[model samples]
Every structure is written in structure tokens, then in C-alpha cells.
Target: MTDPMILSGTSSNLDSLRSQLIAGSEKVQLQIIPQLAELGNQGLEVIQEFLWQRREQTPTPVDGKIYQLLYSCGVPEIKDFLQVNFPQGVVPLKSEQGIDYIPLVELLAISDFQAADRLTIQKMCELAGEEALKRKWLYFTEVENFPVTDLQTMNQLWFVYSEGKFGFSVQREIWLGLGKSFESLWTKINWKKGNTWTRYPNEFTWDLTAPRGHLPLSNQLRGVRVIASLFSHPAWDNKK
Candidate 1:
């Protein structure tokens, strides 16, 4: 049954929500829990895609089970799952497809964007850069199994390694400008998690549908370069 206060006005207190999920009728477990888990899985998939498109290095093999869980849970629930499992660290796994990307679409639907300008598409690649993309795939054991920082720089490094359009190691020199860190982008952009609202500047949030969230545009231009890089690296390409 739905929370009475939820209908009345309490919104949702995660602790209470958890209690209700566990204490509710056993039948609820048979039905509702699965749906909730699906939502969580969906959210994970969204983050996964974000990582892939923005990444500049080799694409890692996708895990099947994680994808399944995300396909079911959606975003908020997935966020909750991450909070429960990792608590302080980030969960960087992909699960499903459409569920996570939808939020970005919803954000864009509210406004009008042109297909030709390519403004939205370019903006997204800028967000992922290269260093951030690299760090996402890097199996870092330090920092308690979490990325310490320099996400943007790591992604840029990936771009250089991949020969992607933006990975200008010496051309644009944006990486040189970041000094030594890329996670600073988090600080540069100013994002935050709120109860129900995400204010821009102070915070920014979007789903997979938005131009900024989409990665194919950038990937299409650079994927070939990355693939070539892979072939050149005999060790990686020849690994058995």
C-alpha cells in the first residue's frame, strides 16, 4: 500500500520508505520490490552510458548481471541502492539503456533545441572530456576503491590515448590548463543533490535524453581514432 503520508504530504523519507518496503505485506515483496529494484538498475545504466560516451580510452567489457539489475530499478531507486551499498563511494557500473537516458530527454522536452546547431551535442562531449572517462574505467584500488579526483583530466588523457577529436595533448592545451586535476570540474560546474529540486549553477542534473547527456555524436567522430589506437597497442589488441 502507498504511504498515507506520501499521499497526505510527507513526500518520502528514505528511512521510512525502507521500513515500509521491508515491513509491508510479504506479498509486497513478491510484486513491488522487483519494480523498485528495476528502477535502481535503470539509473545505473544511465551513468554507465554517460561514462562510455564521455570516455576517451578503450571501452571495457560490459557486465551482464549489473545491467539486468539496473534495467529494473530505474534512477532514484538505483541511487538509493548505491547509497546503501557504497555509502561514500561512487558505483560506476552500467546496467540498462532507456531508463537512465529518459531524464535527460525530459529535461530537453521542456525546452526547444535544434538538430542542426549541434550545440547540445558539443556541450555533452565537453562534459565528459577525456580524463573523466579514463578514470571511470580505471580500476583504482586506492582512495578506498573510489576515484580521488581529476575525473575530467583522466577523461582527457583517455581522449589523447584514443586520438578522439577533443584529446588535443598539445593543440588546445585545455588539459594543461586544468593544472593537475579534473574532478575539479565538479567544482567548476557546481552540481548538488537536493530533496526534489536541482537548481542550476548551484547544481545541475539531467537524464540521458538531453543533448548534453547524449554521447554518440562525439563518439562517432572519435570512435575510429580510439579503435585505431586499440589496434596499434599490440599488447591490448593481442591479449588472450
Candidate 2:
């Protein structure tokens, strides 16, 4: 069902794929999106239908997933449809724990990253199990066991809506670029400067002006172990 090269747009196969896109599990939905994109407008029309149902009025996680995939097709109709329908933001949302990522999508889409960063922490905490959920700060052990799907979903929300300017994946890329040096990585992302931590709510840039991989601010004051856990998580390895 993931590959539909032989299936014409009008064929029942496309309908079945559409059904899969709507009702399939997260893994299935992710697989079918690329196949859906290959169908041209027929494919796009179904994508459009899938996304439209999850519009701001209704707001399902599926809308956020499709939103993240919107750039895959540069077709003028798709572009226009997105601009007209989802001016605020877009994506298909799913989570291992049935976590709602629509809030993160809306926050990112509208460029309200201050709130998005807060929600990002909340979402990650939720994924780390009930203790971390209540604590609202993750322990390294919890992070070591984090789900890649949930992390990728969160990273996609940040990456797509921010025009690729942010996300955990972004941070990880910079981390690796600095030879995996935490000090260098922190400095590169403006999280620290000359041994001084970046002051919250004032020094940090909420918009595009910050250094690359800057938003979704992690509490480095808690020290390196948590941020280290995040940068070293399997989630970054599975970002595709």
C-alpha cells in the first residue's frame, strides 16, 4: 500500500490508500504519504481531503502530518490550497501515547515559538512516562528510553513550521558538526556565551533571529546529562 506506482489516480487503489492515510496507525500513515504524493493531483486531492477534514475547525493530528509533507509537492494547486486553507500552519499529528501535537503545530505555524518551546518540553515529558510527565523535566534515564516516533513528530512540528530553522534534529546536527562537543554545541546554538547561560524570556530569541538550532530551549542548567541524553537519543538517527 505504500508504493502505488502501478495504481492510477482514479483507481480504487488510491481510495484504499486514502482510507489507510486516514485510519492507519502512525507507521502506516507515514508510509502511505510519499505514495500519496506520487499520484499528482489525484493523489494531492486525497491528501487535500485528508488535511481538510482536520482543518482548524476540526484540528486532528492528521492535518499536522499532511502539513509537514506539503513541501514534498511543489504543485501550484497544492501550494494554493495550503495557503488558502491553512494559513496559520499544517501537519499530520500522531504519537505513541496518542499525544496531541496539534497544539505544537498551531504554535509553530503561527510562529509563537515561546509557547511552542514550552509545549515541546511538556510533550517530551509526557513521552517519558508518568513520573516525568508530573515532574515536567526529564531525567536522563527517561530520555534514554524515549520513543523515536514521538520525538520525530515533535521535531517535525518544530522543523517544518520554523522553515527548518529549529528542532531537536537541528540541534543534533549542530552538535555533531561541533565534533560532539557539548560546550561547543551549546556555544554554537547560543545557549551559552563565555561561560554565561543565556537568560530566559529576555536574552533568547523567540523568532528567526536566533542562531541556528536555537529554539526549543533545553534547561542546560540542570546540567549536561539531560541535553546530552537528547542529543544522543535514537530519535535523531531516525529523523527521516
TM-score list, all predictions: 0.20, 0.64
lDDT of 2: 0.75
1-240, model 1: which lDDT tens digit per residue? 997876554324333434454455534423333344444433334444433343443332121122223333446755565455433222232212211222222222222122211332333333344553444321112212222122222233222212132222321233235563333322322221232323432233222232221222222222233323322332322221
Worst 10 residues of 2 by lDDT: 56-65
lDDT of each: 0.31, 0.75
lDDT per residue, candidate 2, 127-159, as tens digits?
Answer: 877888787788888888878888878887777
As a TM-score, model 2 comes out at 0.64
Weakest ten-residue segment in model 1 by summed lDDT: 138-147
